[model samples]
Target: MHFLPHHLADLAALAQMALAFLALCLVGRFVGGRQAQFEIDALAGWGLLAALLTLWGVATTLSLRIPAAAFLAAALVAVIWPGRRPDRAAWGELGRLVVLVLPILAIMATILPSQSDIFMNLMPNAAYLVDHGTFPTAGAPDAHSFLPVAPYNTQLVPFLGSLVIGGFQAGGLALFTICLYLMAALLFARMLVTPIDGADARPETRPGWAATGFGILLVTLLNPGFVPRVAFAGYGEAPVAITLLFAGWLACRAMVAMTAGETGRTSLVQLALVLVALVNVKQQAIGMLIAFALAAILVAGYERQIGWRRAALAFGAAALPAMALYLVWRVFVLTRFPDGELKPLPFDEWNWGNLAPIFVSMGKVVVEKITFFACVAVLFVFLERRLRHRQLDATGKALGLAAATFLLYNGFLVVTYIGHFPGVMSVEAHSFFRYNTHLALLIEFALVVTIRNRLTPWLASCPSLARQAGVAAIVLALLVPVGFAKRLRFDFDQPQPVVRQLALQLAPELKDDDRVALLLPGDTNSVDWMLMSLLHFSAPRRPGLDVKPWDHADQAAFDEAAAEGYGLAFLSCTKGNSLGLPDHASALLRHGADGWEPVKVWPYPPVDPKQRWQPALAPGPLCRS
Candidate 1:
């Protein structure tokens, strides 16, 4: 079967997601509290996938059906469980917002590049999980080296959705990441909008739809530092940002619950699961989880919102599940590959000399966000009197959490840099700003909460202006991610020509046990990894079987393996002067005793033949890596 055209592919992806999200949200709605329903559902959606991936990662299970069946059963239980119904109006509002924004989201997902370590790390792992129904063990074919330890939580969307789609589609993650970003915006808006009623919602007062929308735009579109390309480009940081924001949000609730002399059970499953999902996303996430937890507990203690002993117990209870799950994953990894490459912790390298430069460079990233920090300063002013009186509120707790986490996580980064990246740290802190973006949502949460008192009243007094502002915000929010993301030049499907063309050639020749040598050494504009991925996963099965990248083998070795009946095939998409094959254009060659014989001769990817910007055709440069 042919791969569906790009547009159809996205539709197929969203269809699967729509089902899995419903199942996931049902469990979230039942087990989780009704407050911040969107946040609960969105993060729960992420959490379920994380759980499934963690389970698959830890278990030697041979069937994807185990995770899939568990989800269906839990969702079924959540459905049949007797419970109060959810807020219809709130659900309606969220539904309307999703409808308004989905087209733009779909457009963005379609453009998410099939590049970078996506092919090397994320996609291969995801494709393997979906195709094989299990993650790669110590030695699995078609597995990239990082599969053993690289966090596959980010791969969950595509993996889970592929269960329904019958093959993996990478667009699901971008779509879900955008959706998570939306939920984060809404959650932050709720934090601010509620204050318009002076921190209490009056029974007769209308819901602040306009003000909610207003806050969303401010937190999302107006925040100049939010780069869509980075956030939506299948990075670990985007999901971490959402999970971290949820941590602060739910932690605020826990603070409030403890202050009121009760357990924060309402938010615990979600909060704990959010943490569960967080620590599993990346190794750095465990550091983030600790940092945020410390900030929350410390702030709670300092604010005296609850008795110190009681707060500590409650906070520890909340963190218990996450810590336990993290340990489970650790045990699984250690048992599976005791001497394998898991990238030595705190790194194997140390550089005392780099400390000064790392410190200075990291500080500069903070300074560059002067406006955000300036907002944080104002928040401190707002909380000063309350904290001085030993009577802080959830907003104050959120500020404390974000602030402390900012300090702690970045300081964690310094240690990480000295270890994991000492060489790069000698000059500058690597990806400092990008790493800091994980806290962007929480920072904006504090920013919005600080100003909510004044902004809400101002908006309420002028309903016309608020309504117009909401409309403009909606338009801008939809336009901004697409506009900025396009500027990054990844907004195209034309780049898949090499992959699309190669898959057509290989599917007809290779069998289940056959191996293919991907000798297309790429520089800045073409990629062999992505080509291999497309060949392995783009369709139901003219393609869906595994084809390992045997790049290390040269002509002689390939011929050697061929003589031994390995049926080795070498493919080069580059023009020439590659892999000891001189004066030859791109071709698929079968290694044999008679020397390498051409199985198929093809030019380097020509531009998409269709050319028009229609559903069936892609418009752009021919072979963009």
Candidate 2:
């Protein structure tokens, strides 16, 4: 009877959401009295409020019996109280946006495979940590520590995974991935609503406001650059993007408060933490921090908040903790390379001239990524006129800050990487192009919104120019999505046949407590899918399934394989055969003619002749010395 009611309740809740959104929009239009701006705001605000309330209601009903009921109840009370006032439209609007955006974002993340090998390595590490209450050594044969400060690299993510794996039970790779996905979306949402002094142009215009807010959100969400690297063969840009969005939001807010002669300690502290996290996660964001600092100086100068003594103290207070954490992490964890050795580059190589490629790469990354090359040309003329008239608002100013920071930081990277960039260009070595792509998307959104607002005034004065600019902005904005549509689709739907085939082939053979060695893609280090399936099949205590290195080979590698006790093996032919797995592996070898014999081969789909599969020519009975 309890189960029956629960299922019925679930269906009823979903039906309510569908009906509620429709009602909210109609109610918004009726109350707004045909004012586009008011209707837009009402639609977004009321829509959000309704959605949040609905979810809260359902969650309360579903989760009331749980121990954390008190906490949930308190949270709902606070959320409801804020919207009780007449001027709580923003709260409602945000709530509506949250409901509409968050679910879609979560779906996108859930559907995507965990494109991070780091997640796989972290889950197992978390398990070991739970049992031993200590960080494991990277040198330990069985331990899969991707970073030296194992606990830190494996931060909040693993605990989230522990929920599914049952208190650090063997594998929670999917759980960790889901946490990261949600965290990124949540951070993005928080950043969007966070007020920036310069970004709220024509705050009265609801469509404009909606466009700006949704634009920024889309910049973070829809940009192909946010997609995880393993799927795109990229890095953890999602984490970095989330970090930057949070940092940028805090920085913009601080600038706003400073402009109004108000100092926000919380914003200052947040900015500092974000900077620290940026450097900790991806060191290149250091350039972004430096550029933003310069922009802050510009903003302060423009607003006349240039009290050197006060500014210095405020910055020092915010920055000290991040710096301390960075110093500690660098000294303890980040210093050790995968080989367990620390290698530092020479001082001469770190200079501005050598760093030019980094900046260029960064610039190229932002521009090329959001298809800024196309949009800039379309929106530039109108923005130029708006700047001439001095109609640009706080949003414009913040955007300018972001754009300048991107160019400067990206330029710094370009100079640093370019001297050697020519040599490494072909190999795509340390390019830093992907991060730049995200920066570009951020810049483009700001530029488009600024241009969109500026053009309306010009429609009266220089109607001809206004018409051209309007047409261009709309066309470019439309095209921007098209440019990125391929990448997004790829992320959403591209077939990972190599990985799928490997997992499917190994699925039937898998049983409770059976360890399996699934091959990684050659030229890449992704492993979550294979590892997740293993967890799915064997829980609590699965046998040792070793994922052998496909990079450098040594005796220790062989020793690790022998320790795992894997009796069966499957390899991804695409993940090259020559790296770590030896020709005389106990279970299987690379093109060997020994005691081994072929069992089964499941090639990737499309079975095209060109779609090659390496035949596992094992040693048959006739083979002898």
Candidate 2 global lDDT: 0.41
Top model by TM-score, which number?
1
Q: Tell me the lDDT of model 2 at 560.
A: 47
lDDT, residue 556, model 2 = 43
| Clashing residue pairs found in predicted model 1 | none
Please give, for residues 47-146, the per-residue lDDT of candidate 2 as tens digits. Answer: 2332232233223434212322232343234333433222445445444444444333322222223344433444444445444333344543344444
The C-alpha TM-scores of every prediction are 0.82, 0.58
Give the per-residue lDDT digits (tens) of candidate 1, residues 278-360. Answer: 88787788888888877777887774547667667767777777787788877776776554434543544577678888878
Top candidate (lDDT): 1
- Worst 10-residue lDDT window for candidate 1 reads 196-205
What's the true lDDT of residue 582 in model 2? 30
Model 2 RMSD to the real structure?
Answer: 11.2
